[model samples]
Target: MSSSALPKPQMRDLLANCLRFHIVGAIIVSLEVAASYEFGVAEPRKKAYADSTKTMIPHKDFEERRKPGVFQSTK
Candidate 1:
């Protein structure tokens, strides 16, 4: 279905939903940042994040090149 076929209310609802989602996300992220600063464990959290989130090199989906990065200081 093309967007032009949709009613104005539907478009308004879609835009409102998107705005609400972004606002909620921003508030949650701000709260997390405030908590992180108050707790003062940024270094440990950074190391943990570095260990968990992988930066995978581009590869075909059929081939699994699951290699852990070697540069993490915590490792």
Candidate 2:
């Protein structure tokens, strides 16, 4: 067996993959931000409108509670 051995090159591959992952992530985030701004799909006006118009539709449990009588499963 030789006293000297080649050093492991695993770190180089790991670093390259990490850099690539970050670059891809950055690109995806940038594109998403650009698309959001371009389309204005997430504007506050629409959100406010939705919030203002939001309402709760009562279900079977609510009706049963309101009557205050023997419980019956509507299922």
Candidate 3:
């Protein structure tokens, strides 16, 4: 109500600064969350290797071995 309390330009500047501060803070928080997700999420799972030199059976041989008559029983 009193002109001496605060001039119009200073009041406008103060209000503008407050709004800008809040907006900048929100943007910073959102960027921080995005950065954290980029760095922290989606780590690749490590496979355990008991014998690194062991080779996998060929697909054709594996299929034939599964057949009952194709593989003879030792007993």
Candidate 4:
């Protein structure tokens, strides 16, 4: 029997296939995370409203009424 060498796979084809797989996987993972956040955290956080306890004030008035050194670094 004659000895024959099997064809070697091209680097470009291997790299392309790997890149395509990774891109598809990343897209799927990102979509899943976004869906989970929208359903789990985003919706719940909005409805839970730890902000409800705090009074809402006008932005300009709040800024103007701030006491000096209140926001300054203690150092």
Candidate closest to the true structure, highest lDDT: 4
Residue pairs clashing in model 3 are none
lDDT of 2 by residue, 1-75 (tens): 999999877855798899999999999999999888856865767777778667644575578675765556532
lDDT of 3 by residue, 15-64 (tens): 78998999999999999998877666633111223232245557766677
Candidate 4: regions farther than 4 A off: 1-7, 50-75
Q: Pick the winner on TM-score between candidates 3 and 4.
A: 4
Kindly report the root-mean-square deviation of model 3 from the true structure over all alpha carbons.
9.2
| Whole-model lDDT, model 2 | 0.76
For all candidates, the clash counts are 0, 0, 0, 0
Worst 10 residues of 3 by lDDT: 44-53
Model 1: residue 49 alpha-carbon error in angstroms: 29
lDDT at residue 2 of model 2 (Cα atoms):
96
Worst ten-residue run, lDDT, model 4? 66-75
Candidate 3 CA-lDDT value: 0.65
The CA lDDT at 67 in model 1 is 37
lDDT of 1 by residue, 1-75 (tens): 766775556644788899999999999999999897867887778877887656544454223433354434433
Off by over 4 Å in 2: 1-9, 41-75
Clashing pairs in 1: none
Ten consecutive residues with minimal summed lDDT in candidate 1?
58-67
Residue-level lDDT of model 4, residues 17-64, one tens digit each, is 999999999999999999999999998888767575355556655565
**How close to the true structure is residue 69 of candidate 1, measured as C-alpha lDDT?**
40
Candidate 4 lDDT: 0.77
